[model samples]
Target: MDTLIFVLFLYVLLTIPVFVLLMLFAVLTRSARLRRAAEVVSLSACAALLVLTFERAFEKPLLWIVVVLLVAVLAFGVSTIVKAARERP
Candidate 1:
């Protein structure tokens, strides 16, 4: 239970900056290091989410956490698309 809470906490807190950093990276130089970090964090979070969803341990309130995760994922996607559009000739 403690471990689950910790993971949820990490996801909630870290996701904010993760989205911001991803968007920030979209605007700034195409640094591979930042790109890799973003990919790892996002991927790890996604995998964790999948496992939690399947495990059936998270309670009702945790659904809100899932919503936040969805928003973060959307942010990442939108930022990537907008960045791509801005870079086009």
Candidate 2:
């Protein structure tokens, strides 16, 4: 379990920059596909973060902030995906 948590932490750390780059490209290119990809990366990252937090049993106040941020990111990703779907022909 500790190994899994550590791996997830690493995954989240690695994806942060990728996610930012994806979002930047999505915005610059004005592509729905890029936007969707960025959201998917964000959603996965959120899931990883959530798992990490849960594995630690929410032992720290800092983890509470992580939980809040994860919830917000999940909400944002869902909303963006839904909106993109609705916009698609």
Candidate 3:
């Protein structure tokens, strides 16, 4: 279980950049659908990770790191939503 948590932690750490790149791609393409999809998927995945982290007993440091990542993902997701809402139809 510990090994699984550690692997998941590493996976999240690595995918942070991938998520950023995906958002960038959405922005570059000027596709609201793509942006919304990316935000939804990213936020869902991050929330799942957070839930998994909390479900198991883990070190404080690892929990803190996951919390921080969750916050970042939340912020990004909110910003994307607001931006999409503000754009002219």
Listed per model in order, the count of residue pairs whose N, CA or C atoms clash below 3 Å is 0, 0, 0
Off by over 4 Å in 2: 58-69
For candidate 1, lDDT tens digit of each residue in 42-75? Answer: 6556656655553553466667666576657757
Give each model a TM-score: 0.47, 0.75, 0.51
Report how far off residue 58 is in candidate 1 (Å): 11
Tens-place lDDT per residue, model 3, 1-79, is 7787777777677667767877898989987677777777677667658766666525555577767777787778778
Alpha carbon lDDT of residue 65, candidate 1?
65
- Which is better, 1 or 2, measured by TM-score? 2
Task: Show pairs that collide, candidate 3.
Answer: none
Candidate no. 1 TM-score: 0.47
lDDT of 2 by residue, 1-84 (tens): 778888999999988999899989999999878877877887998899888886565576667777777788888878878887
> Which stretches of model 3 miss by more than 4 angstroms?
52-89
lDDT of each: 0.66, 0.83, 0.72
Could you report the Cα RMSD, in angstroms, for every candidate shown? Answer: 6.6, 2.3, 4.8
Candidate 2 is scored at a TM of 0.75
lDDT of 3: 0.72
Ranking by lDDT: 2, 3, 1
RMSD of 2: 2.3
What are the clashing pairs of model 2? none
